[model samples]
Target: MVSVALAKPLDPCESPAPFSLLVPVYRGDSAHRVRRAIDSNTHEQTRPPAQVVIVRDGPVPQEITDELDRISAASAVPVVRVELEHNAGLTNALNTGLLWCSHDVVARADADDISYPDRFERQLPLIEAGADLVGASMHEIGDDETTPLALRQAPVGRSEIARVAKRRNPISHPSVVFRRSAVEAVGGYEHVPMAEDYWLWARMLHAGADVRNVSEPLVGYRVSAGSYERRGGPRVFLAEMALQWKLRRLGYVGFIQWATNVIVRGGYRFVPLKARETAYRFMVGHRNS
Candidate 1:
């Protein structure tokens, strides 16, 4: 079993309030990747995070625990680990971190994602700008770690974000920073299985929280065929379509609607890869025009 520690409770008058970065770890994750994330926060050129709350689900290997201990010792920032007796999934792990966090701001990081040097620096202002949530663009990095594929940018500003979010998920979860109060107000993370981030955003928006997106890429999101396929492929796509149907009832027409239209118009035979490409080209051309 891994060692666990609950952060000490704090009063409301604490000076230089810190930001809590919640990281959830599961089995099969590379120790080197975890170390890199810790190092990135410690060596941050801008404002470094005050604390990193890592939740290790289930009984991790001894080697991984040791590596975490070593990294925590060398870290300039406070690193706290929470151990669970059994794997309760991402939503539960994040809830553990949320309970342990004592800061006003909460930031999220995934084990596989790499944060740019100025990620925290760039997000701090937006968080202070009275926005409930802020996320930045991400550069999709290939497996070789050197090749960059595409850049994803989320819409910024409350109104623009609402317009775009109505169409699709405009913000990336791993690159998001938001107020703790806003998250709590929305009832925190939900057990949405594969679409946890999307569910959380929908709930937050429903609760009247303002969301924004930064125009700059501040993180590298590793994307692979395997990862994409595991996200439920056709089942996931259909699930999203159902979710969007619900959203439309709430007066939001999502991107899935457009995709579904293309799939239906092009016939199911072309629905797999080629139709997707065609739809992408049409959307890009429309956006540019």
Candidate 2:
């Protein structure tokens, strides 16, 4: 078992160290899943987290709040809950959490995600090694335990990530760990209604930040089947395309590559449910890609 001895309480006014993990939660998510993600890190063998800030967009159920309270009591790591008076969108909630980050490095977590035990243990060293941003491969999980979903790996190295970021988001937002200075230098997370993380990555690259990827699966991204189908529809694709075009206008990459990759990757939508599940199985089990 990994030890949690190094974990410590967070001081709001000053960063105790160089890294803090931030997770933003909307009211409707499954509290159990959120607790799982939080527990994974708090129990891991890691450099003591300066804080694990969970920013809530609005009021949550009593049960969920109680769960948070229980997690706080059981874990040595400080779990700070920041509640908003009203429901704000993801971008605003994330920025709110960012303001509370008291560390030079910031890691992101999603409410429904399950991070591997070594997720931070692996990424933090890379940040200390001087990479401005680092992300790892992700394994997708679904509601049905019998089937898997998509497994993705991003390019490694700052130059490669920069090249990929020009066309598409090479890193998974939930799996990314970045330098607070680099993010703040880029003016923080923009209020893009969609693809906010992609937009921020492009902005960071334009500002000359180094980004890289660890070649290991460090997270299990839950894709609620119904949610995926809805979000992966044409409207979101078009919105993403528009965001990519905005990146092009900024001179990060040409429109052709972005368009081509979008079309090619978009073809995955045509995959039948069973085929998609099969592909995920192969991707998850296959070591080398």
Q: lDDT: which candidate is best?
A: 2
State each model's CA lDDT, in order.
0.70, 0.72
lDDT of 1 by residue, 170-277 (tens): 678989987777777767787764657877787677657777788877877776665433433556556555655555554445467655633543243235565554
Cα RMSD, each candidate: 7.1, 7.4
Stretches of candidate 1 off by over 4 Å are 1-17, 143-147, 231-234, 245-270, 273-289
- Quote the lDDT for 124 in model 1: 71
Tens digits of lDDT, candidate 2, 8-49: 224456533456889887778787877887876566635546
Check candidate 2 and list the clashing pairs. Answer: none
Candidate 2 scores a C-alpha RMSD against the true structure in Å of 7.4
Please report the candidate that would top TM-score against the real structure.
Answer: 2
Model 1, CA-based lDDT: 0.70
